[model samples]
Target: MTQPDDIAPYDLAIIGGGVNGAGIARDAAGRGAKVLLLEARDLASGTSSASTKLVHGGLRYLEYYEFGLVREALGEREVLWRIAPHIVRPMRFVLPHDERQRPRWMLRAGLWLYDHIGGRRTLPGADGIRLDRHVAGEALEADYTHGFEYSDGWVDDARLVVLNAVDAHERGAVIRTHCRMTAARRENGLWHIEAGGEAFSARALVNAGGPGANDIDRLAGLVPARGLRRVRGSHIVVPRLFEHEYAYLLQQPDTRIVFAIPYEGDFTLIGTTDADHSGSLEDVHIDARETEYLLAAVNRSFRRDVTRNDIAWTYSGVRALVDDGSGRPEAATRGYELPLSDEADGAPVLSVYGGKITSYRHLAEEAVDALSKRLPALRGGPWTSKTALPGGDFAATEQPAFIAELNARYPFLSPADATRIARAYGTRAEWWLEGAKNWDDLGIDFGAGLTEAEIAYLQEAEWARSAEDVLWRRSKLGLHMSGAERDGVAAFMREGG
Candidate 1:
């Protein structure tokens, strides 16, 4: 193909719209690189949205001696909370003591290391708690009189991914959803890429595909030196088992732990079974065995006898972890490996192997630093850590005040609705909410809190096309809306779009 002067090559082209890819795009673009990010489907439609929804230091990783991974992830918790206070907030977890599991002394030691090892500064330290005397105690079985209380964070996993892409786009990065990469090859010291029936060129490429990283490597005609172990993490949502705010970290019989978290104000989120996956990546769903396993774990720990009938919803996602030949899927390392292909052989391509959402910012920083060596257009150092994602511009402590302000500005909004909008959009909630003096001003109420104005904003700016994108990924309002109400939203999106 002849070179076209009209078409300028992007400094960086990235595959995948998950946390890692979007984070890298944000970092690279802020550092002055012209970046392009391509996603096969909607952003965060893969493993990114399917996470356990935590910005936490994997406290259990201590058992596997993954000190470095835990420490780095711990350090990111505060950073994420600081930048995206709207969506990220502190949560305390109650881990009941099970005599059959690890001994008390070992648990204490692990908690101590977890507190100090990661340079803990903002979050409260872990301490022993009398569950019988606590609000969280009401939901637990009588056998659990004592446990440990520790701090972690909760995140809107899908929103986190979307906000990163939104920030990247605002900073000059091009984000294209439904643009799957069909082929890629290094030619004439540049990467000529084909995706979604379109052609493009970039000085450098990034294979940040989470579960499909290996597939991307094959597409680029490169042999991967390391193997990836794809592990499935499944979660289930049930009716609220506990009324209190505190979450539970239950120890399973198989030496694995399950979390029962307060979700969407009306349900408790649980599970996250670790299973080695070798199935097709499309439409990943919770298996009957995994569902029973999670139910058994929760039923054993909580007072509620949550059977299969109580399951409100279930979701499953596959994680791409570095395969270290571990006997168990959970033992596989969450630490990512970024291998940069030698520029001497061809155009450099950085492939992201494995990482959790907590350390995505750090992972992106490291990825950009390595790629900067190959592409000189990337001129700045790390800025994503201090910078806020899109709507998250206010201080973390000011969120409550922001919500109050929203209520004052839009007195028509219910307190719960105000809080949701504040948390989801932070300061930017005013964008679509502008000039709406009453509920009807926001357009057709599709029930639950979704309105026509919000849907328009989602479509115009957030790349949301279908009703499912609005209902599931962008927000969990699907769980709140009735089937008929959801159909109204769907019909509106179809005809209105």
Candidate 2:
């Protein structure tokens, strides 16, 4: 078996390349610690990617009196938005209030608290809007007379994880993808970690395994004080169903809210049912019931009806939420918990609990603080707040100028490619598209703006290992490709293309 030889033991061994793990690794690496991030599968392949993709303070949690979590998440919103303006831009959500549901006064009160809680500056605060008077209310059912619009940010959740990994690597952290941390144990006051059928010694271990956080803890021979509920959330995509870029937050009969947002270039990404899940992690998938549920939810509020046949694609993932023992999945806390186990004469494992994609950066910072007691030698103050992620070194407020500048640099490039590259990669897109004087210079086209050069860049730089890694998680090109085109890309990858 392969092993890291003669090199100094890593300061921390992080299991799981999900948002929490990548965030912690980036935090640790930035703090001058030797870090190694190991992922059993692709980064954000679990709950991270399966999220509703909003970076906001949980407005609903305000009703539950989860003030601290909401405030922290709300506070960190601008921090994340500032770091990755291209990926994490402000999104306004229209919340159509139903008289049958919560009352108008109660909803107004909650929105007021949500607005004031986070020290919100750049994004507009929530406000009441009449359905008939507003442009966003055009698609809503005629009976829905009253609504509200609030500010939040939408993120490419998968790319958020990849960007964290990229930032970690740039900070001198070693990243191992497709490498599973199969086992971990304590040895000689340090951690003995195994990954990809190999072993290593680490001074500490961070179990940011998302749904598998508890499992990782058990493998490290520590008992968890809490267990995460594996709540499977599924999303169904259809051809663009709404006119506005603004997302809709609708209340269902079940008291759960569903989001219908414009996805990619020409599709509506509607999702997310919070069904309690207990199955093989690899077998997590969207079911016919979930499909019907989401379709019904969207169709209930919109003038257009979405049928099962309208589904362009479907994806599912399990959210590892800190089970407050609330049998109701919707009532489950969206806040993350860091539990440090006390064991005599061994290294401690910091197990991360429920966390959202929006608060991942703050979650990472908190996890690092949990590890501060052990390594007094480790310089630990605070860093990641104002720091930019891998490609987001731009003006925090706008990107039109950046896009215009990129077009000037590559006049021969199509507007679509140039715009996408500028938005997704920011200033770094130039490095990948270097020397490509024309469309043909980009090598093979994988359809939907994806090219051979992009694929190569993903594998070589972004830790993308499979076709799904590129198409679904890393980018949204899967929504535009035929099955045959996807199969060809997979075949080419397997053949070392």
Candidate 3:
């Protein structure tokens, strides 16, 4: 392990723990670069975790005419699913065609381009569907006559970030959670970093601070040629808006669309309103207008009438979109830019701006490629595309069989519990379930299927420090856990369990 007291300078220091930062850390570490990753808070606590949790090509971007960005993201969809099948699963989206919103021909042309542009394979292509005959149609209002069905993938967004950090650590990267970089400066051709009251040195620094990218750049005494426009996206979870497994892509009177996805087996996840965010990054939540907007959009297509009372949970995140001077917040580009500054007498600093979760791996590959030109120590070519993340060695097609196998091995666990474990940890579940033949062997029950054994594993391996870190980020057990149960978890974590 790379100890804190070791004064040896690292080859790279990453400044955030979001998906991009974690991806970069993993890539850099795998390439044999001595790396240090610092997060101001827990991993994926910011924009990473707050995503709509879809790993798609941004179908809506096609309307914006972002062909290059769409192609890149579309190509990454299957690659990401291949490496992390446990977290990324194939999902089919139902787009109900409302003639008032967009012409049917336009939607058809866009879907055609989306299907063809990315060299798509493995996933089924887009096709028109009759609402009267499809299983997805059962949930919609009777008035809806036709729609489109397309393929995308869903991800455990927070877990993806954690897995990347785990992979990075296994490759000898120093993973520091809750370590905020207070200051950074160049001295003697090296970057001196002061984080969490400790001093460290690196040959290069990465400003992967998602929403704070510009702040980090300014802290490094440089201004980005382009600025970032912060946009807030909010989501609401309601008790199973539809019974079907298929997700909905509803069109609104405004050009923007809303998605209603089946979430956590018992809830429907609806979201994502784009509005100009103008507040402290720490305080992001759905306003009444956004909630109303989302509910209205859902009401337009579904037979169900949902209100605030039906909302089981709500979350919001701010995106650091590159300021392209677009008139609408939704019009901002989802592409990323890695601006590298190399001074004559100082080390280089690369700042990441405007990226989506779907393309994080590619962004990291490009970022490290840029850094390797300055530091010759970074070894190896792109390897992550072919590598399996931590526990994702099995084929995506074998998920059901793997879950059944897990249930057979641990007969004491219920089927749901077994499936959850298999999905979350994949083959890695054995690392914690080893030698445990029954429930008692897993230690004290913390409710919501969370056990002391699992908590210990998360703490020891995934850097989970609190109940929020475990329940909210590492897993979505918070949605299923009660207030008293959650408090017990908090108390247990506080008591050093």
Candidate 4:
């Protein structure tokens, strides 16, 4: 195995490429710390990409009396949108009043608290909307006469992770994808790390390993006070269920809620069932029961009766929640805990227990703050709150105008393709379209507006190596392409393109 050329000791070594780890790397790098991030797989190949894709305060958590977590996440919703407007856009969720579930008065109270708790300034407040009068009601059954509309944000989950990695790399952090930490030991007040057939050293180590957090801790020979409860959440994508721009939050008979959101221009993404999982994390998928459950949830709320045949795709992610000893998996806290171990004779290790995407930035801030005290070399205070991720320079309200400008600049591009590019890359789309005057300049077309120029850009800039990385994570073009087109992409990637 060839050794990595730069073996200099780093201020921080992060062991996961998921959202939390990437966020920390970006934060620490911006703080002038020499950082190194190693990932066993593609960024966000695990739980980060498989979220419900909403950046909101967990409304259901209000019942659990987790007001602090809800308030913190609610505050982050707008902050995240402001920082990454290209990927994080405001969304209105319509929750049809279910008499069998919570009472209308209680629901209204929760919404009121949700609006005021997070100092909401930009996003609209919650209000009751008559489904019959609202555009969202057109696709719903006639029985759903009334519902409540609340504000939240939607994110391209996988891209968010990659953007953090990109920003971290730009700020002088060494980000190595497909690099797994085989062993780590504290030697002479430093972390001696072995990963990807190479050896490295760092003053501090962070275990932001998501589902594999415990395994990472064991590799470092430290036993935590609390273990992780590996809970599997699954989602299904089907051909468009509703035509409206608004997403629906349907109440289940079992006191759970499922979201049916518009997805990929021509499909509806529905999901998220929480179940205790004890299987291999590598082999997670939506089982038959999960599929049936999701379909049933959609069938209960939508006028269209969707079956298994309508499912376009399915994906599952397992979250490593701090085992709070909750009887139900759904009741587990999405909040995170940072347990830092610093001994007199050993280096420091910070293990992130559990966290949600909405609160990742705050988690990183706190994690870095803790480590900064132990390592004096880490300069500067929290700066990520005011800084924008790469490609996210415009204000949140200017996205539509930005898209319009992109279309006008690239007249040869179709409106759909232009819009997709504008949303996916934001102002950075200009870089991909830099020298291209027409469609032919983009080189070979891979269907669904996936041009060779874009593929090359992803490979060169975003650390995308496989067809799956480009098609599924970087962009959801796989949903729009045929099997032959996908195979062509695979062939291109396999040829070292």
Candidate 5:
């Protein structure tokens, strides 16, 4: 294990490589800061990747009077979509109106406010739909005859985190994926940091350790923030249950919302039952009650009842929320809170409390802007809001042409391989393919559209440190590949390691 002292001191050190941490690192590095990003595990292995994968204003928050949050989120929606059209696409979510829930007028008012909030330009506005007359109604129960469809966007959450890190690294940030930040304490007007048993120093410190922010604060010798709530949210995947691309928003009897969105290509991603978590972040798992709660929510709205037997996969994540002492976790604020060191005279460890996948970029920019206050010599201001993320730089209009061009360049590559490469690497796919002339040129196949060439690119270019990085986070081929294929990839990565 190597530490920070093993290398030169950085202007700033970011604790976590999840979305917020990675985004902050990218912003800080882009501004010419000597930045180092340390992640205990693969990036987005926490709440960032386990999100519902939507990059839109939280509609339900309107009821809770989260106007500012919704507005900010809505503004970022189009910006993020334009930056990464291939990974983030507009999704129309149908919110079924049930008398058991709220009245029709109240729901309509919320939808109206939601549609008008951010001055949306790219996505369509909300519309009232008669579920009985539309195909979206096929899954809904007969009692739910009406719904409202509003537009939000879906994202490849893991890809978003990795792309940010890649962009940050490209801008001269040192990112260690499997590296763990063991300790940090301020000394001599600078904070001493250690990772993977190595040590380093930085003028400023950022604790963006998603769920592990608690330990980070203690290690940095700072008192814990007022309220850091760890809430566990889980999702379940099942075979595709509908034909349309639109997602469904069902109101649970408990006033909570459940989303059933079209996921990957063959399955629907449903989830997210929030449960209070007081457990270790490393050991979070989906409780059986959560599974039952989600299943019942779906069955309550859809006529096509699905049971536990239909579940193809399940994932659980812990959201590190800035608990405002809200007894009800569902009503918990989704906005981020920045808690700065109190008694520290010079060197400060700024801790990020709460944030979401949708608002990570803005949150990152905000974090760096705050950091700029401490280090006035920093060169740049907030530049990430408009700038495209790594693979997101290419114009959206050019993606189709670029994919076509990739297919032309790799005549021997299968359509799926070319598409995967195009989506994953964008224009950089050409550089990854290099001069490979044919299928054999791809080296060994690791199954599920994975090639040795791509793996090598990840290892060399991307900060991929393990098989899980390649399979689960870097690319989601794990879901489609056979167990044997995953084992082969693991073996290959272990041999390389």
Candidate 6:
């Protein structure tokens, strides 16, 4: 095919609506570039919704000598918190001292490195404590007497992706969910593409498909990256194991770590077991072996032994990790690579592989910088880090005060409801809450305070379509709803409400 002189309208067309893709879309759009984002399903419906929910440095990665990766992730903890305080909050993790695990001095040294290497400022640094006297000790086995405390941050991982897409849209990017890219070919110095049965053209294309990157690369007429591996991580949610808000990082004999964190107010989120995934990537689920392994790990650490019946919900996600050749799935590297391929006469194509949730912002910035060499429309320096995400304009530390204000402003809302709204939507909760007083004003109560007005708003603004999108991705409200209520919500969405 002969090359043409005409240019495409969109400077960048991003495939995948997960964190990485959304982050890139937001960054490029803010830099005054014309952008288009496409997702095969609802936003965050894939690995993004089921993947890691924390915005912290992976402490266990330290043992693997991934110092650079850990430090990079650690530095983003407070930055992400400052930028999205409503959804990202500081969390203190309690690592109880086990005689069978690493020695006390080694633990102390690791904590010291973790604290100072990241340039700690607002959050508290690590310190040793007596579990026997600490509130976090109540649910631990009696043998545990001492523990180490460290600071990290937890995020509504799905919302983080959604907010990025929302910001990207607000900044003049076209975000189209349920649109799958079917084909791509380089022609006339541009990307001539077929997606969702529609033809389009773009100056550059980014394959940020995460775990499904292999399939996406083939569609884009390129070979998949070699030595890539998919690691499946599974987690379970059960009734609260402890009354306190503290989270635990338990060390198993196999050198694996499991987290038991307070979740959704009344549940405890325990997980996860990492193993090589040989199953289908389209549908990831926790197998019996993974579930049993998680249960055993939790049972060994906590005083209360929870069985299968205690499990309220379980989720599994597969993340594409760079194979470290250690043969252990847990040993795979969490670091990422953004390879931009620019031939002598075709539009540039950038593919992302193996990135952690905590460092997505940095990864996106780097990706944009790589593409900027070819696309002159991508102007300006990095700006996504400094600006607050959608609905996150307020100061990070003022969340509690904001919750209090929500209660006062909406006197009809209970304190719990106010807190949930503030955490999910932050300053934007008032978008749907401002009205004639009382819960009825919000419309149909689908249980757990999920209102019809809110569902409509999500569909209109956040690209939510099905009940699963609302219940699972948009909010974890399904965890609190009865079966009948959940079915009712499904019916409503199916009826196109």
Tens-digit lDDT track for model 2 on 280-354? 897689988998999999889999998998899888989998988887897899998887767665787788889
TM-score of candidate 2 against the unseen true structure: 0.97
C-alpha lDDT of residue 185 in model 5:
78
Backbone clashes in model 2, listed as residue pairs: none
Flag clash pairs in model 1: none
Q: Point out where model 2 deviates above 4 Å.
A: 1-5
Model 1, 1-497: lDDT tens digits are 43366999999999999999999999999999999999999999999999999999999999999999999999999999999999999999988998888888888899999999897788899999888998888888899888899999999999999999999999899999999998898888889999988888999999988989999899989898578999999999999998889988888888889998999999999979999889999789889899989989988987879888998899999999999999899888989899998757888899999999999999999999999988999997888889999899999878899999999999999999999999999988989999999989998899998998999999988999899899999999999999999999889888975
- Tens digits of per-residue lDDT, candidate 4, 369-450, equal 9999998878989998778888899988999999889989988888898889988999899888987889999999999999
- Model 5, stretches more than 4 Å misplaced? 1-8, 342-344, 397-402, 411-417
Clashing pairs in 6: none
Q: Tell me the TM-score of each prediction against the true structure.
A: 0.99, 0.97, 0.98, 0.98, 0.95, 0.97
Quote the lDDT for 257 in model 1.
Answer: 90
Query: What lDDT does model 2 reach?
Result: 0.85
Q: What is the C-alpha lDDT of each candidate?
A: 0.92, 0.85, 0.92, 0.92, 0.84, 0.90
Q: What TM-score, to 2 decimals, does candidate 1 have?
A: 0.99
Candidate 6, residues 1-497, lDDT tens digits: the string is 22233744589999999999999999999999999998988788777888658888899899989999999999899999999999999999999999899999999999999998886789998889999999999899999999999998899999999999999999999999888888889877778778787777889999989888888989988987645788889999999999988899999999888999999999999887888888887789999999999999989988999999999999998888876687788988899988888467478999999999999999999999998889999898998788999889999999999999999999988899899999999988978888739889999988989989999999988999999999999899999999999999999999998
RMSD per prediction, one decimal? 1.1, 1.6, 1.9, 1.4, 2.2, 2.0
lDDT value for model 5: 0.84
True lDDT of residue 90, candidate 5: 82
Which 10 consecutive positions of candidate 3 have the poorest summed lDDT? Answer: 1-10
After superposition, candidate 1 runs with Cα above 4 Å error? 1-5
